[model samples]
Target: MHAIHIERHGGPEVMTWSERPDPTPAPGQALVRLGAAGVNFMDVGARSVGAPGWSAPTGLGVEGMGYVTALGDDVEDLSVGDRVAWFYHPGSYAEILAIPATALVRVPDDVPDETAAAIMMQGLTANHFTTETYAVGPGDTAVVHAAAGGVGLLLTQMIKARGGRVIGLVSRAEKAATAEEAGADHVLVSSGAGFEQRVKELTSGEGAHVVYDGGGTATFRSSQLSLRRHGVHAYYGPFMGVPSLPVTDLPNSILLTYPTVQDHVPDREALVTRTAEVFRMVQEGRVVPRIGGRYALSDAARAHRDLESRRTTGKLLLLP
Candidate 1:
């Protein structure tokens, strides 16, 4: 098997596409033959910041879509050749690897392999953002930063499906079309200059009921400013470095939240339920993930460079 190995994390060059012995399934695990692997910010964080649960000289991804080629002892919930997608499983940037059989989400027949891998983490995060974080309702307005990006596109559609109006913030003019197509009631160029004022104007002077920011520091303050008094500022990811916004600066009684899908999934059952809901939403035509780009298994380095460039839109994947 081949995988992207990072011996000493520093830059994209550290990820070397190299050969490794095929892994054997341990108890309750299944050997998954990789189809597609999702390249996410978390993977970049692992490579850049040396995030926990990883040491040097390991694979570089945690979410992917694959097939069960073999199963270990006592694993009966899933069988061989079953197509599945998973989140938080290590060594995903490989041709084959072992994963807990129970952690796999059965991908629907209609969702393509790339699409399934792309949505597993991003869509699951979106599910919790709207349904749990703030419970966006009818007549509510939301400002979704990075509205053309992976989770933002899905999150925008989900909020709209739940009857909330969206004022989507995009970094460039090129992204405006995608955000609007994703059901953003209003799309504004998120130049980080006067964007909060634009959100207020879009909402007729009453700020948005909820603000969903996945771009981190680049859009943090504007996202906070777009919120109404007592509105929810849902800070999600750290794409442009984490922000140091002061809690004292927020309006009185406002709800400031930082939700991660990993932290929200309390147990195996919760993980299964959240993933199932994301899959169901896709099946119901409520959430659609845009596959911005796909790189060959050996070209993982190029994928990381493109993702950090901020020029690419939607989900990026690696085809194994």
Candidate 2:
């Protein structure tokens, strides 16, 4: 089978479509034939500078949906031909994968292959941000930075599904309609700082109840300024820039947290539960994922380049 491989960390040019041996499922594992793979900024980070678990001479994907062609020992719960999807399995860019059974979730019949693949990683992250990081209640206002992006769009819909209002922030004027179409109550076309006053004005002098900040250092302070007293600042934008904050400098008695999607599904049971909820939301037509672009699996390098440029909106998928 062919897969995307990298020998050294650098630009998207480092990615190569290479041939590899077919993998056989081991105990408690299932062999999946790729349907589609989701692209994320983290994949770019892995290819460029490298992350803790990702290094050179490795495959470059973590989220995808496929069919179970076979299952290994003790994997009695799943059968051949069952459609399944996973959010985090390293080396998912391959044509086929032998993923642990515990990490695989059955895809609903109503959900299309590409949509199922698209929602797993970003959907779960938005679920965690809305539920645990800060419970979004009715009538509450939220400032979602990069509101037209993958996680941002999901966050906006989920917040609205819970009866909250979204104050979306987009860097370019052209992206405003995209954010509004995803249920953003108000969209601000401003980059870096200075968006705080607009957020306050939209809220009628009372700031937002929470800020889902993914804009990094450039808008970190603006996100904080847009929040009300005791509001929650959920920072999950490590791909842009990391900001340093002091407790003494924390304004408005607000709380700050860096939430990870993994924590929302720490075990198999949690994974199943959270995934079911996301799928349910999709079934209800309340959370529809917008596909920004699609690329052939062999052309994943082009997908990476588009994501790094930050010009694309919604989710990008790789089809095999």
Candidate 3:
């Protein structure tokens, strides 16, 4: 089989195609013939920082969907030929993978292969962020950063579905429309200043009840100011670099949290519950992921290039 093997940490070019031996499923594992792979910033960050998990001479992906060709002993969760999707199975840049049975989730027949792969990570992240983290509800005013990006789009809709109003902040005019379409009550473009003021104006001076700042460092400060006193500040991504604000800066009863899926879903049982809800939302049309771009497995480098270039929106997938 051929896989996207990374020989070093650096640019996308480091991810090169190579031939490798076919892997057989081990006990409690399943050998999946990948149909598509989801490309995310996680993969890019791993590549950039030389994350020990993806050190040299390693394959580059963590999420994908495919058909199981074989199942190892003790794997009663699924069977051969069952269509499934998974997250957290490293080396997903290959045509096939030997993934833990626990990571597998049944892909509903109604969902397309690309959609299943594209939505798993971002969808689940958005699910827990809005549903469990701050518990957004009616009359809540929320602010979403990078509003048209993968998680942003889903998060915006989920917040609205729960009856919360969203003020989407984007870097470009085009993304503003996408976020609004996803149910953001208002869209604001950052001009390197005054985001908090804009939110206050939109909410008629009440400010937002919660601010989802995935834009990382660049938007971190403005995100706090955008929130009303005693509001929730959910800091999730580090796209612009990891930045932290002193607790003293948040006046009143403002709440700040840094939630991670690893901490939220400590085991397979938790993952199953989260995935189930995200899948239901997609099947019910409450959440729709935009398939921003598709790339051939051989072009994994180009995929990484486009993703880091920030020239695309929604989810990007690699066809295996």
- If scored against the real structure, what TM-score would every candidate get? 0.95, 0.98, 0.95
Cα distance off (Å), candidate 3, residue 264: 3.2
Residue runs of model 2 more than 4 Å from their true location after superposition = none
lDDT of 3 by residue, 1-320 (tens): 99998777888877889999999999999999999999988899887776656677678899889999998999998989899998778889999899999999999889889989988888888887887788888999998887888888989989988999988888788777788888888888873446988898888987888888877677777877888888888988654478755768775578888876666567889888888888888899998889889999989999999888766778899997
Worst 10 residues of 3 by lDDT: 238-247
All candidates: CA RMSD (Å): 1.5, 0.9, 1.6
Per-residue accuracy of model 2 over 80-109 as CA lDDT, tens digit each: 999999999998999999999999999999
lDDT of each: 0.86, 0.94, 0.85
Tens-digit per-residue lDDT, 69-95, candidate 1: 999998988889889999778789999
lDDT of 1: 0.86
Model 2 TM-score, all chains together: 0.98
Residue 302 lDDT in candidate 3: 94
